[model samples]
Target: MKSSARSRLADRNGPLIPNIDIARPRPYLPRLLKHLFHPVFAFALICAVGCNPNGESASGKRKKERQKTAVVEQRDISFSISVAGEIGPAEQVSVRPEVNGRISELPVDIGDKVKSGDLLFALDDKDLQIELETRRTEIASANLEIRKAKQELDVADQEVELDLRRDSITRAKLEQQKAKDDHARNKILFDDELISKEVMQSVESAYELAKNAVLQAERNLQLSQERFRKAKERARTNYELATNAVLKAQRNLELTQDRLSETRIVAPFDCTVLTRSISAVGQAVSGSGGFNSGTEVMTIANLNEMIIDAHVNQADITRLSADMEVDVAVEAVIGLTVKGRVERIAPKATVRSGIKGFGARILLISVDARIQPGMTAKISIPVVSAENALSVPLAAVFTEQEGRYVYVVVDGVYEQRAVEVGVSDYRFAEILSGLNAGETVSLEMPGEDAEVKEMPAEKDKGKRG
Candidate 1:
């Protein structure tokens, strides 16, 4: 009998087998097998299986694929502006000979270290020596002339005194003549018999003596006056000529001495000799020399200190100052970076390739021995550094009408969030506000096909329940 059936199945010929065995169970296995394999039962069993009809797996995958996101976290952020420049000596000069002559001696060679006043080269001073001796001789001769001039001046003074004496004699002769005239009148009165004999004799003697003295004075005065005039003329002429000779001698001496000093080339400051162009003992060089402006005997520079001449964009100039620290990396020195500070910034901008830039000088605080001039250096100027700041990949941030923003995933849905940005770099940007840490943000726009769809309120409630 079938399990669903309460009686045993009977065959067309009689019972194919006994309906029941008294010591065993009824023969219902065949009926039970047939019932279990019925189409309706199979349909009901297949339909009740745990297989999903809503494509929950596909929906889950779509939800995960809807967006690629990163968690917001705190990190140290910094900004820098890169510029190209060349390394050079802090102080450099082209050594030149101060005097025009053949180089007599060159004591210092290329790459030689030198101190202030150290000898680098010498000029042939034979001509200068001869000129110097000549000047010395001229000075000695000038001294003799000066003495002779002084002596003549003294003689001229005596002549002037003699001339005055001669003038006094002329005046005395006139007074004597008047006294003789008075004496002649008194003698006439005494001779007329009205005057005393003593008065007549006294007048006669005085007049005679005065007349004799006048004659002698006139002769002496004429000779002395003529002698003084000639002496004074000669003395004045000699003194002036002697004074001029002395001055000329002194000037020539100084010129010759200055030329002699120029023969030895001295180092203006402590430096390293970079190059030497003159080596032969007799190569003539001029201070302002041929082909090139002044003969450049050698090039010397202070190697202990170095500077970088960099071109900075005008837009970034405001962020730099003399005290601002900089990072310098020389291309020739691999993996080497040195610290430096801004030493100067050009006030005017230079136009290059239609862009404006300012020239800047960066002084290396501690220079390395390996660092040389003319190396190309890439410098990084520090702008700002923010520690423990909220930042995201630069790609994650976007700008729209609402301003800077990022896509945040909320309930598997992308929501636009506005953010305030601060310092930034090539890799990331700092978020100042409008966002919190640990929030997930989308790197790019999410595809609509991969997005999760929200159901109605009733359906959602039912699904939750």
Candidate 2:
């Protein structure tokens, strides 16, 4: 009965019992708890000691902290700005033909040197020559006509003078004959009855016939004089017309001769032949007014007076002014740099949609023998610069409500430094004051947690006092 009772009790408690091995030691909970609490307790004690208000005077302690926080360092810096540009000549010119013609004679080729007045090419002048000859012939004919007209005018003038003289003499003779016939008729009328009526009638008839003859002769002479005057006036008009025709013909002939001379192209100035499109002989060239008008027979340029034509951005043009110094480098002649200046800026900007920029041109200050026309070049314009100035990298400078400031490393602590700035470039800025050369400045400062505390009111009062 005792054993059964013991068995029943064991079964009832068996499900509730936890299994354990004698060889394995139980987990040390007390030890783990002590280990965890040890660090926490120590941290609390540290905070308590640090926060003690009476241990150290706040002002003295703050002063010590300030000393500890100040930072100091040293660095090297430079200030400069960079802009792109290109090299160009001081003077350059483009050469084109003045008259249109095919090239009959081309005396030079590319790179060939030529002097002023040198013949470059020739055009076929056959038509011009013929036209000039025709004009000259016309002038000769007009001149002969003028001479003939002058001779006719002189003869007409003499005939007019002779006719006037004849009119005067004949008029006087008619007047004398009329008077005599009147007198005879009056004297014979009274005696006619005695002398017989038939005889008197015959005398009167004779007188009348004679008087009519004299009058007729005078009228004929007057008509001849008027005819001579008209002939003289006609001759004078013809002579004048012939003279004007001769002058016009001569002028036309001269112009045609000039056109003929222009057919032989000549260099306007010393230049180099860049191209020759014609041969020496058998090449037919048309005149200026022909179908081959404006055709290029050859090309010439003044290579010695070369200029670089470069385009700069419009945004940068405002910073550029005339006479500003520049440096140029030609790709064709590498390792060589030429000096130049800003000669001019375009008033109106040229918008290039592809690049979304405008362009400007700069003139080279000087020339070099190696430089040639059409050579590619690069230019560097210093928009701003400083020498031996107190400067720092742009990153080291920052703005504040007070003004521009920099993080100066004062005795190993970052101290906010107020700085007056001057000229600055993209990479650097000139620090006018509050910083010295060789002094270290921070590019960045620690975050808010690392911020230095402000002094208390009492400390500030003492400092003011």
Candidate 3:
């Protein structure tokens, strides 16, 4: 082994070492060979397995394949706004009684589907029915009295006509004058002894009787005129009274009928009853009149048309309006997605947890039987979307006190460049200025002596599970 070491050394430097004695190996030779040759073997093994075939370090290979970033390219970008909301019915109402009375029948129970004008509850209406009947009878009596009064007026008018015929003063005067002439002729005949005394007396008596008949007829006519006037006044007053009574009775009947109609509590629209508080058959209810709030019988909801009331941040409210498209997901119904549109954005803002936001209603376009009220809904609204715009990954965009910027790989070097950023959907941001299309950006900083791999940065990472 000694001569082999000398010959190997002589090969490198000729005649550098002199001849040495051929002796047995030393005691520490094993340890020396172990240490020396072990390093050489380890170096050969490392060259075979540990380093790249091209003589690059393992870390250099890793640097070559390190996570590369995306480029600022002209691509259609849609910035979405995420807000949490709950699914609810488009219409909900609490039912109450309109007339105060004892509940006679509560036919509809909880979870019962009902249509408009369907009877849900009934109140005791016996009193109203009796009152209506009494009003009707009064109306009949008034009509009968009106007929009687009209007949009395007719009789009074006929008597007035009879009196006018019997009391003619001019005819009475003519008869009296003729009687006087006849009596005077008879007296003259008696004085000349041509006629008897009884004849003149008889003529005078007939004239006097005719005159008295005329006076009695005139007096009877005056009395008949006064009586007829009084009868006419009385008849007019009685007819007016009867007609007014009829009007009053009719008004009363109408009021009673209105009250009777109130006794029936009908559904205002097609809905499903959610709750019912009234149970006993004889339970009392109150009317929603004056200051009374009335009793709540049940809660009814229209579940056919569902909506999601999403409270959006006030900062994003300006971008929302009527008919904005949206996507909705319900946790209760996994893997089911429904499309919707914004119905309205509330004018007023609501404060919750110190955050002020406007409530936006998203009306579901599709109807499903499995949908129910009060389900948690996740709403996605795309507020700002730009087509064929330069965009970059969000991680590449860094914020500073002045503005936003990104590290772009220019000439194989990371160049910190200023950039103008527009809307961001948390995964990618639209680049407005200070960056051009096809400019490569870095997701991470490479080491001082390392090369950056040209791998693309992942997009839409937030959407992944």
Candidate 4:
């Protein structure tokens, strides 16, 4: 009956402990293990050990019981703020054509270093050349017209001189005087009755004829003078017109030459090509106009001088000023560092990356060839620094209604003392007064039961007053 009951129990439940042979001597067992062999009892034990009313565990409680303190000592303390910036050339320029034309020759391309006056690209000059020849031809034609007008002017002057000759008028006057003498002598003979009436009448008629001839000569001379004046004026006007045409043609020629020269674009300074927009030869570009800046052919920059554009946090901007030296590290180049100086700071604040900051430009004092534009870099700006100053960990300082204070350790007791603080950094604060070197201060607030006392600094101030 006992063997049947034990088999039924073993079948109903899984084995909790390894089974021992009944034939062999029974092994010794620990009392706890013997009790834990019961499944219900083992589960209760685990619950009692792990479950607690307080949230903290055993290790956490022990860690809280330890007091944290720091020793005040004279040490070198410094603080620096770092900001990310982008590397760029100090002087960058976008090259554009001044006159519209197709690019014929592109000598330099992206990444090419060029000097001032070096040819960068050229435009198709065949059309401009043909236009230039046309302008020259116009100028030559104008010169010929000018020469023809000058010859006509000379002829007009000669005609005026010839018209001024008094030969016909003088001959007419001489004939009129001879006819008057003959008329007078014939009248005297007729008065003496020694001449025929018909002869006298003929003499009178001759005198009248001579007078009409003189009048005609005078009118002809005056008419010729007027005609000569008009001809001379017309000739002068034609000459002036010809000269003006020549001037206009010359100006056109100069304009054509200027346009032709614009076909060849050259570098304005020593620079590196930052970008190239002209992909191939024969790319047509437009000239700058009233509303257009023209097509950009390329971008060049003075890579020898570089600058870092960074936005400094508003909290740290006040501590920075122009000409302040800083350290720059390139993100792309490992272990590369260079010196820089603050060149300018923005007068107003701007938002970048959801952060309000002031723009700052740092000129790289030490330029490296590997440093390229658009590369990201970090700039370290020194804000506050101290050397060999009495300092303590920042945690030791506390703020309350009384002011900044630290809990100093004295004779195994906590002393609440007021402190005058100076410059500070992330991990430490410089103690300007009310604290001395080789002093011990608590990092955390002391318990209420701990012996606490106020330092005699207040009393000392009273006595000094």
Query: What local distance difference test score does each model get?
Result: 0.75, 0.60, 0.74, 0.81
Misplaced by over 4 Å in model 2 are 1-102, 160-165, 168-189, 192-199, 277-293, 308-312, 322-327, 339-344, 353-361, 379-382, 392-421, 426-428, 440-465
Clashing pairs in 1: 289-294
Positional deviation of residue 74's Cα in model 1 after best superposition, in angstroms: 2.0
Better of 1 and 4 by lDDT: 4
lDDT of 2 at 57: 42
For candidate 1, write residues 1-465 as lDDT tens digits: 222111222333322111121111223446546766789976654554535475344334445675357888888877666788999999999988766889889988888899999998999999989999999999899889889888987877776667676676777788688887988788678879778988888877887777777777777777887777788778888888888998999999998898799888899999999989887788989875345577889999999999998888887788788878888998899998999999899989998667698989999998989899999999987666778878777667665544556777887887766666665555666676656778887777667664543222121210101
Error of 1 at 7 (Å): 94
Give lDDT tens digits, candidate 2, residues 334-370. Answer: 7988776666666666655443333545666566778
Best prediction by TM-score: 4
Per lDDT, the best of the predicted structures is 4
* Clashes (candidate 3): 1
Clashes of each: 1, 19, 1, 0
Per-residue CA lDDT of model 3 for 1-465, tens digit only, reads 234311211212111121222122124435545754577866865785655567765444556785567877666766555678988889999888777899998888988999999998899999899988998998899899889988887787677555564646557767888887888888888889898778877988988977886787777777777777898899888888888988988898898899899899888899999889998789998887637889888899998889998888887788677997788888799887788899989889999778799988899999678788888888876655667767777667654455445678978877767665654454566666666677787765455785544323333321112
List TM-scores for all candidates, in order.
Answer: 0.67, 0.64, 0.66, 0.73
Q: Between candidates 2 and 3, which one is better according to TM-score?
A: 3
Error (Å) of candidate 2 at residue 391 is: 3.3
